[model samples]
Target: MDLKLSERYEDYREAVRVFLEEHRSVWRQPMADSDGRPSAAGRSWQALLIEHGYTCRTIPKQYGGHGGKADILESFIAAEEFHRVGAPTGLANQGISMFVPTLLECGTPEQKERWIRPTISGEIVWCQGYSEPGAGSDLANLQTRAVEDGEDFVVNGQKIWTSSAHFSDMMFVLVRTEPEAPKHHGISYLILSMDTPGIEVRPLKTMTGRAEFNEVFFTDVRLPKTQIVGERGAGWQVANTTLKHERGMLGDPGQANAMLGRVVAIMEEETLDGVRLIEHSGLQDRLLRLQARAQAMKLHGLRLLTHGLKGEDAGVARLIVKLNGTILNHEIAAFAIDVLGELGALYEDSPHLKDRGFWQTTHMFSLGLIIGGGTSQIQKNIISERGLGMPREPKPASKGA
Candidate 1:
């Protein structure tokens, strides 16, 4: 979608471009620790973004964000430009994309004051603690426990598939605060310091041969009750706020543009049977379709952003964004793999190959995009029950019946 950039966004766009140009030297593929934020080098990259006015634009003035009347579309545009130049803006880190928005909506004055600045500045890193060994897609069924003790909530539970937990200084964890309360009811959202005694972060290797995820175990890790974001036992609701942001970020069209650009780059230069890959009518049609979808998703995102600027709900498009975006991502990367044939499949062994075999890395990482933020299956269910207002499937009757 061609953006109608008025004077309002023109300066901002130029500023972002300049930032990318100046900092190009520090650029590499932003390393993700787990939840897809910059890890190690990513921290330095993000700290610089915050230093410039490129990030934290929506944060209110009082809470130490760039505070102003910036529209959400600005962030999207910046993302596009960043990806185009291969810069790591860190604007889309789960911390910025998911958690900050949640805080803006529900955080208390003190809570926002205490956490927002440091988080935005990259002084503290965060890992999500929602998915458990048992709770992967069925998140509310989480079994981690947090018992109340005076002013503290003593936590004991295990969270698996936690990204960057080993490298983070803090975690936003969901724990069952009221054991007797219904499964969904007793959960609470709390910020826990990773340094707290009895908290263990152990790396869990992925099929990709990298360990950006971890299984975090907590035994009696105590957090002040004041650390809770919403009211006690309201964690389920609080978590939904984060998820909504997450799904939106995941399904964003700007991301599709990045992937599509990579595919086009490969298609133009690659060959099959001595014929340029892009010269193939069939491959050309596929690229056109992916481009169209990227445009559609991009335009849809702008529509949502327009509504947001008008203080309207981002509208029905919100529901399908994650599902559609993630699937297209997988397809685009898969197409590149098919075109490159063996070279795309090479990893560290073929350091001389294109993207240092990062195409293969991206192919594997694509599945995480599908699985994280909510699996594609769960997303379909949301589109059905929530978007189309379809009746939910009936649950099985208990034996007592």
Candidate 2:
């Protein structure tokens, strides 16, 4: 594939750089909340990004986006420029990153008009309600029920590992709408307000000292039947769309490369026993291996984009991104901690902690991502059956059989 950019793209890159420089101070300010919700200033910055065509560039202006024509190269250039300067590309949340794309693909025109604007603009926050006590990896086994009651579906059951559910305004959920149908066939996708009666959110605290994940319980929650995204019993397909976007969002190349840059910076600047870590032959080999892997992932991302533009199937290349990207990010953060040596043990709030304990935080959070969107084992199964033309994994026999 050609790596060289045309003159127009070159100008686009320069414009992105100038935009970042002009708004660097404003973007640099910390958000009031750290658990993925954007603050007022952060939302303003996101709006600025939309206005300047730096983010949501392909989504239509009617939905509060840039409404530009599809240009993967330009999008990539903007991302590169933002990461190059350590500026946030835009506000990425469950609402903007995952749900908006799904809604654009499967939602009715009225649904888009009602939700997309506030969702992308950070005026509305959304949480996913897919995983449950029994349905995490084997999501078809979900037992959450939403029975029809006149114009509404009375929902009851629970969803665990729901990130930001406690603070979200809405949810895109899956439920067993047709109990007599086959497991996958019985599911339906529905959207509902989080503030509805009979809904409860209990936050789950992680080892990182954050209560971002939650267990959400719905007790006879009434949602209008009109809130269903696709036809009843077609949620599995619609959810696949959301899952694809979720994986892409979780396995962000820009964030991975940025974290690698931070690791490299730490290695060059920090000394171990009076010798720089980068100068050590053993450490140099490790860093080189990581840099090589990072470059490969970047090239793979470009190849995926190329396939997308050409209307070609990406095969396993697309499926491998989330698994490999998450592992690579975790390994890179682990390498930074190793480089930090004793200082790595120090958590945030310590005056002597390096990079304000950012690497340590990443190390923990990255591990959760490996399990969040889908586990590494689950991803391998998908690559094998879906990408490699292999036979599907055999299901376990029944108890009496």
Candidate 3:
């Protein structure tokens, strides 16, 4: 685990910094959809990232990517650079973050050829069809079914909390293909096009006044046999690969650090008791703690990346980092709101505001971090069982049993 970047990597870092600086003004606009939906500007930004070899940094050069080592340190640097200049990281969602990695690991060469390049190029957007009304954290109980029909599978059922489904062109779905087998063993993963006739996307509005998530209905939506990623009935295993990717995306410490920097800047611009808000000891103490946590999380991320590069299991560590990261984000958001006092209530673009009303929006958006990816409770269960080696929780008894 060398922390030292090679001369080449240092050069790469400097190049990325210069690109971001040149585009800083373009990236400064706040994304339109605060519910984590990608905006038109977001899509354009993603294309710029791909052209500059930032998106899919980990994909091999042979596969139409930059062929970097999938290094977490590099990801950290990239995230920090983007956040420092108020730029959104291209395609920071379950699709690019989770599904792309799964496809690379288990997909056929044809599938990769069909999907990966387009995804990286921002020509196609993707969503996850994992959670159903009944299945969320108990994802093994997912009811979306994909019945085999000749050279294609006919999918029917519904997916809930599908972020970006409305704007996405494709979705990576987990479907129940073998009803008679046990819950976890009877599933399969499929890639389905959103334009398929039977697919319906209805946006779900949240407290943030944004339609960021959607309820996706599949009524006989059909996918070609070639769309299946891994073997049928091995969806649970395939999902593990996706979750590992999710953990990495969610636990990214660079995002927290970026938010911390924004808070510091806001505090400097603000005043209280005839002095700057940043000079307040209470606020300073809290910011210091957040900075320390961000550093620790970064180091932990490095360890996970080193192990992952060596093909080692990092599931437990991923969960631990995600659990800690979300909590830290919530705390930082809370402090920002408190420090802003009455001014925190102002929305973006409001009259006579500080930092263009970003603090208020950030405070509102922070809660989603805890709930999305996987809930805090779900992360705790993983940590308890895998990290502590605790006994599995007892399953509820069936009515007939």
Candidate 4:
């Protein structure tokens, strides 16, 4: 079997390398140019990439995207190059990845024209409104209400664990529109301006001392009738599409490999018992194992890409990669913790800390990976029931407590 990229892709890869090489130093310490970027340099650098078509390669050209179709390998290569340089890969991503495709698949022409370009250009930002305090993993049980009132839906409920909600200018949300109907059947999807009155966003800070998530509460916030993404009661299906994209976005084998590379670099530089860490047999063994796993993930991703190009079902690969990516990342982080030893305990502003306290930060972040997008438990359910066609255990309804 041919393991290498086709000649066309290889040429594209070389072009990608040379273009990314020119910005290596700038990317190393870019200023945030957009609201997402804390400095203007980072924003400017990303804008340059977008201008040169080094990012958003998967997005279609009609939505101010690139290269027409979703080119998986090209998209992978673009992200790999950026992550390899330790650059902030967050460009105009909500639109570029999740929303744009969802819109293309499900939105009206008007909605597409109104939202896609601005979002891709970073003119507007979007946040998802799926999980509520009452309904996270069991999202069908959400109680957030959106009452159809004449031409508007008056929304009143709260969403928890909402990433970038505070920074978002708009939200694509799921709300219970039919109170008496069954849980999943009653849900509806809507897009609304964040500036709408009676909406509130409060930051949720993580252990890393970063407020990357928000708790957004709505008190009769109103959106126009035209804002609904699909049929009112069909939101359960629409929301599922949005979520499938969310879970798929979690696959980034390049990021995983880059992390492993960082760990290897540390081993090469650090010494243990006056002997170089590179010479330690146990550490070397563990590192080699992680390297192997990362390699498997990369190859699996390539296999998935090939299948996708042939219009074949790669859902099994998708399911496996998500679980593999999370586990491999957690293991890498855990090993880094050991390497750091006492330095792992140091966080924030500590000069004695290794890698500027990143080891501790990544270790904490790894735990979230197991939960983010979809939990590891949920992925196992998917793998068993859908991938392997396992019989689901018979369950009785819960008795009232």
What is the per-residue lDDT of model 3 for residues 1-401, given as tens digits with 9 covering 90 to 100? 46887897687678879998888765766544564456667766776776666777777655566676566556656766666665667766666778778988998888877778767655677888889999987889999898889998999999999988987888999999999999989999888788999999999997777777899998988778778889999998998976555534533556677678878998898898788999999889988888898778777777877776566777677658767887887888888888888877777566767677666666667788787767999888889998888888897888893
Q: For residues 282-378, could you state the per-residue lDDT of candidate 4 as single tens digits?
A: 9889889888988988778777767766768776676777777888888898888776667768888987888887878888888887888778888
**Local distance difference test values of all predictions, in order:** 0.77, 0.85, 0.78, 0.77
* RMSD (CA, Å), each prediction: 3.6, 2.5, 3.9, 3.0
Error of 4 at 124 (Å): 0.7
Model 1 stretches astray by more than 4 angstroms:
1-3, 22-53, 91-95, 103-105, 243-254, 281-285, 306-314
The residue pairs in collision within model 1 are: none
Best by lDDT: 2
What clash pairs does model 2 have? none
Error (Å) of candidate 3 at residue 97 is 2.5
Is candidate 2 or 4 superior in lDDT? 2
lDDT of 2 by residue, 195-274 (tens): 99999999999978888699999999998999999889999988878655533332346566667777878888988789
Instruction: Candidate 3: list runs displaced more than 4 Å.
Output: 1-9, 18-53, 68-83, 86-88, 149-152, 244-254, 273-275, 279-318, 348-350, 398-401
Weakest 10 consecutive residues of candidate 4 by summed lDDT: 30-39
